[model samples]
Target: MKAYFTYSCILLVFVLQACQSNRKTETKNGGIVKYKITGKVDFNDGMQVYLQNYDNELQQFQKTTVKDGEFILEGELVSDGIYNLIVKTDYKDKDTGKKSFRITYPVFLENNCDYEFKVQKYRDGNVIQAAEIITNSEASNNLFVFEKEVAKVKQTWDTRREALSNEAAQLKASLMTIGKGEDSKYNYAIDRMREAGKESQELAKKNPREEVSSLFVNKPEHRTSLITPYLFKYITINENNYARYWTVLDSLDASIQQHPLTIAAKAKVERVKNFYEQMPVFPSITPRNIKGDSLDISKFRDSKLLIIALWSSRDRFSKMDIPTLLNKEPQLKNLGVSVIYLSVEKKFEEWETGNKSLGLGLNSYLLNVTDKDFIVNNYNVSSFPTYIWVEPKSLKIKELRGGDPATPDFLSAIKKAL
Candidate 1:
């Protein structure tokens, strides 16, 4: 009997040990991110929090409802990447009834790690803006540090630019009043601007391996404009330059190099290469009209100057511009420009509905091409309601206009282009 009791106790101990071991393994292997928030704001049960992964074209978002100011998000990340936290709150206004406000924060997420964030909000009238991140992971700390440093540089640069602008303005005024040659003042301003730019470049070059370098490579503003000039100045495939420009990219971490921002940079480089190699002309496309008839864009090439409006049903600007386009049809025709509204709707039903409702008495066509990428890439259509003016004879793009076409400036630009 004594032997049997001892055996039973031993069996229970083994089972308990196995259960604890399994729990520990699951916690370690499973990519679970737990978050705790403590702040002055009132927390209600079931408040929602969202995590969005950064992407070049579209962001992937995940949501979880907060419970007692804490939430555990479960997902497996392939690699460490930047993520955004978004929280939205609705407040009932005494007069307006209800108003919604959003607060956002950027954080770095590593695979299989936990994070805690403290939300810091500052009052800006009725709306609240996220001011800072009090506590976060090491990666997040590094990213913020880089951002703060960049902000300081931008502030100093702006101050110097403003001072130069003031000096230039004064010089120009004196030249206008006192008659001629004050070109030296303008030259001095230009030289100062150049020097400031050099300083900024040197600052970035000083920390090429820092995680913040990813910001310079990936951030839209930096990659598109701020950093491109410096990069192009050094990068060459020729043997003489030693490919120093390419080495700047090579020095970055592999993860940063494979980031979406890096991908966008590569695309930009390819575009520049293609621009030099290919002729500047619009690609021929055959799409269907609302009445199910095929309309070849090439048919309009030699007939008259075509003003192609690329729009979608869901875009508010596109919907608003439809009426504007219809209103301006007579004027456009008078100027020898024919308008064609191309709907890039993904669904046939939505396109049909929009065509019937919004495109009444307009030359409207649905983008019926199967290869959507080809259309977007060839035309360089980044957003909806994009207007392109094509020359009648050469079939080359004369001008590209974005935003509301109904604006006076837009109409004036069209006339000027013609």
Candidate 2:
């Protein structure tokens, strides 16, 4: 009897150990996410909600159905990441008939946990009146709250901008006709615009160490103009600032750093490093002309200044920019600057056609390299219609412009380089 009792006790211990192992395995795999939408529910059963992995290169999407105003999503995330929950619905408008709309909510997700979201729809059926995360994770909740606050700040700035714009238009008309009475109003609008900029700067500085700070770093829409200067000032490559910037980046959730939205921020950090560490010389490569003759960029070292314009024919911005560069050539030539348009188009025929269509009078070359990564890495070219101004004697990149050439910012960079 004693032997049987001792064997039974040992078996029970083994069973408990097996259960603990299973639980650990499950935790290591992934977690569950439960989402519930409340308020006006006009949609039918089995309406689809998409879960998109936000940081992934493949942009993996998973779909679930809303049954009784709720859906569950389960997955294994190797690392914490930002995921998007998207819902599509259609409604009939009183005036315009039926229209379809999409609602997207971003959530920061981690493994081995469950997250719940409750979102409300407004009477308009198109607007999300409010959204709240019922999850226990404070970091995830804080990110969402911070995003909402940023949205509010942006809205206020936009309102002020519109008012100032309208007043300035009226003031311009007044100046053309009378030119005296509305000057104070115009000046007041200008002052308000400057005030709005300061407010944006202050909002960004509020949480420099948080993941939300990445939002302010390099917003593509305002990259070359509004945000770039702020980033340059804030993330300077000095010893103390560099260490602080790295610390902030390291502190972010691993997935956020890899997110598409944060690519600009990462690139900015790398740019700071490159400026301090990397060689200042441009790469030497000989590309072919329309006639298939090699035109060595190194040969242009004798010129006082060399302007290399990297563009693709398919890009809408390039269509506008190529002509602008051609038009400015005479002025550029007078200033001892020579312009070269290098086509990065995939096909030689396309390059030929685009070059002919542009009616380019300045030097032109077709990038003949089969390895696309070489050009991208060497030039640090992220987008098309990129202008790189080289000081030929040293091949040092004196100025780099990635935004619209028509902007005063780009013009100023060009002037400074000259």
Candidate 3:
């Protein structure tokens, strides 16, 4: 695909920006600051720019259209808030003669700020990634700097993953060409990638045994853990966002740091961090398998992640990811992950029938009624079909988050290693 824009124009695809309001209003906080957002663009004319807040909702001040080369936007912010100025380029493909994409970005905003939004990098055909966004506001600029720093870490993580995957691929290909068996290097690379959260996308899709423990992640969307410039707002990337937020909060000006929102956010981040850090290891369960064999969940004394799936036969959605897990058992094993399917059914007979009817497999078991309270309380199993990710080594809890996991908020907590 062709590139979206030239290098000179700045792209403002910020991962997060708060409170970009076109309304000229005052706040109870006292100071009413206005924003002067001006920048050069790659377009010629009839380009549209819209305002969006951290919520991902398009709260448009107006349907704005401007000439491509240079543009200026004016807005009032009562305080520092998250928002984005999304630019939908009137662009066309010269080669394919096709109209490409309408692009938008998430950028932060501050009252009384002068922001220079420039075109940066292109993530794909549709999304334009601004290499840099400069602002006069200290608080806002701090966030930009902080985001860049955090993005670097995220990028480094992905790059290492890519490199490991590539090296593993090269080794495997060389072995194949020579008609030889697997070697230590291949196993080492695979283990490293597993530690890094995922393996090579091509390999994962090609062999079920090579896929991530998440299972059935064949789509391209599953490949990208996303670069720094992503879909993030006040809460950046689940657990990642809070750490960065805390880091920036420490560096902000005293008054800005003391701002009501900042205070609340700081408190929340601290609370969350403390809660997770203090989260006790998952209590072990020794339930009977569908095979009528005794099983103890705490036997794995190594670095293999445990994906404990809690579901009921009555709740259809509860067993949704089960078949995929079963079919991709090899894949899970490769990733050093184990699946423990515990049905939260009331009757033992119901679990027996459900397992046969649904073919829940040997890994599936009915949570003993006596053990139900123990499992439910420890795992925090509220809903019917919940997948609890228990961390390896520490045996701490890492649950599926991100409100839908598909959304910006999904295991998201799995940012924690298995």
- Candidate lDDT (C-alpha), each: 0.58, 0.60, 0.56
- Residue 366 alpha-carbon offset, candidate 2, angstroms: 23
**What tens digits encode model 1's per-residue C-alpha lDDT throughout 138-169?**
44555566567666766665676576666656
Top lDDT: which candidate number? 2
Q: Candidate 1 or 2, higher lDDT?
A: 2
- Candidate 2 lDDT, tens digit per residue, 249-343? 54444334443334555566666556645634666767768777777776667777888889888998899878887887787677777777888
- RMSD per model, one decimal: 16.5, 12.5, 13.7
Model 2 CA deviation exceeding 4 Å by range: 1-45, 53-60, 77-79, 90-101, 120-128, 179-244, 250-268, 280-410, 415-418
Q: Looking at candidate 3, what is the lDDT of residue 142?
A: 40
Candidate 2 at residue 404, lDDT?
Answer: 51
TM-scores of all models?
0.37, 0.45, 0.50
- The local distance difference test score of model 2 is 0.60
